[model samples]
Target: MVEVRPLPSADSPLVEAVDLAKHFDVSPPWLTRVLERQPRTLLKAVDGVSFAVPRGRTFSLVGESGCGKSTVARLAVGLYTPTAGRLVFDGTDLAGLNSRAAMAPVRRRLQMIFQDPFASLNPRWRVRDIVAEPIRAHGLLSETRAIDRRVGELLELVRLTAADGQKYPHEFSGGQRQRISIARALASNPEFLVCDEPTSALDVSVQAQILNLMKDLQRELGLTYLFISHDLAVVYHISDYVGVMYLGRLVEWGEARSLFRKPQHPYTRMLLDAIPDLEMTGRRRIPVRGEVPSPMNPPSGCHFYPRCPFANERCRAEVPLSITLPHGGEVRCHAVEEGRLTEAAVRQALGRGASAP
Candidate 1:
């Protein structure tokens, strides 16, 4: 059996996602369904996912597209109503806020930095107005003059020219727009920020700058982040902890260093393989063989069994329970739990340079 440590109680986590889920009923209206001969369908975007972020830490979600990573980001920020689970922010259950009026306090304390800064920001609005919108919405600053001054301070904080806020979103580069997005998120002085692929669209060099800016801001403000991205390279760079999600469930999660060094799941191994190996002189990255399985008809037992090379009859029929490993974490793999697959095979598959998370 896996030995589970209560994260918040143990290391004092700043953000806890406890059995969080979001299911969507995608069925059409009954009358339309009858006319079109359609059946009611449900989409499980996020299913019983849980993880915690210690104070001043970066917890990232990395997975393929449509793997519920972005959905979790949305659910975390209350952009979508949860059909089954609840969100606990700082020990308070979010469901207790029954009314939008009651949710105001929580709203001001939480913010989101969205992907695609070009699309996220209003092209019509000047950058000053763009950053100041949050300040005005949350009543963070009383005077209009103070709001612009605050926006200027935020611009400087993000390492952007304060005068740049005078222009529109199109006036800046992809990276600069993203910085503006970060500044806007910081305007409300949120304790927690849900960053949804905040750098996926930018150039590799610019990505580093944005990442460094985020890290600096986190250190200065003591912010907690639910960082979302499909890129493992970026995740490895910025995250203190990493969570791997597939088809709506977290197959593996642990400290960033440990997970990269010793990924316990076959799927996790595949993800690691996707990143370019800088260590090997003439390295050839073995691309993940197959496309992601359809979420509407996910495979049974281990959802990754179809693509996993080590999978056997038992793996196809029975779900593996999480097993606590001596290396400082738990792994959800039948072969690992049953001791059917030895550590050597895992090491060979992952490669020689795999280090501890």
Candidate 2:
């Protein structure tokens, strides 16, 4: 029998990832490599990432397109096994669970919302079946009548009526299809959700609607979330804590308000600078320099040193360990660690006056 563990206290994180890493072998075939005298290539999609999602709260990972946020999402839900490190759900180490049967109990409480709603749902499956799949697969409801009733409840919970479930996925609009996806995810009564750019594919107006609905659901169900997105605006709205990723590693992470108000890492500041200055603070925004380096051949020391303005020889030669910040959270930057990147220096670099606050 699968051992069931008690849920952790509210004060403890519901999901924790410690030094999580996922590497993909993207090299040429063995035969081809032998003939061409080429070395094998490994893509470090997520390298040594760590974070925790508090129960009933959202922890968001934000970064550029290839920064491995989605890979982290998949790792959280067990879609891809981690190449190293541990993924702990509640109190159980997911990697320690050896078999599919052993993983079932834990899997039932975790679900994922994909980027594209149109592609996630089956074309021929009715919305009812799609939403009911998790319930049946988990054997949560055996009787037809009970399952149907539960499906109706799930649909209504996502703000869609039972009647809508009778139709196919193609019959609904993009937003409605995503709603169906949410309903399906919720059908298993999951305690945690890994949402991977769930709103990116929708129109801006519709994105707000979906985000609002997710927030409402969280409040109502006390669900935990590991949200992945490239949009800082969206992360700002939904996240209680935020981690900024670069080259598969978390560069900076802390409470959302603190991190956004006073970003310490150069990459984090660069990202915030890219946001339009709607309040017209007149702070000179630094245009991000250089392209992101390929993950297969990341720089030797700090992965971000190539584009970091404050990088010195030390930064280029040695990896910076994570340093605890005064307010809260941690940053992995040699400049920040060595006291070279002070608040005044950051403000000056951004062309902001001392009084600008």
Question: Which predicted model would earn the best TM-score?
Answer: 2
Q: Can you give the TM-score per candidate against the true fold?
A: 0.90, 0.95
Model 2 RMSD in Å is 2.6
Q: What's model 2's overall lDDT?
A: 0.92
The TM-score, computed over Cα atoms with residue i paired to residue i, of candidate 2 is: 0.95
Q: Per-prediction RMSD in angstroms?
A: 5.7, 2.6
**Candidate 1 pairs with clashing backbones:** 257-356, 257-357, 258-357, 261-355
Largest lDDT belongs to which candidate?
2
Clashes of each: 4, 0
Q: List lDDT for all candidates, in order.
A: 0.83, 0.92
lDDT digits (tens) for residues 19-44 of candidate 1: 78887788999999999999988778
Model 1, residue 265: what's the lDDT?
Answer: 81
Which tens-of-lDDT digit does each residue in 130-177 have in candidate 2? Answer: 999999999988999988999999999999999998999999999998
Runs in model 2 lying further than 4 Å from the true structure: 1-10, 280-284, 351-357
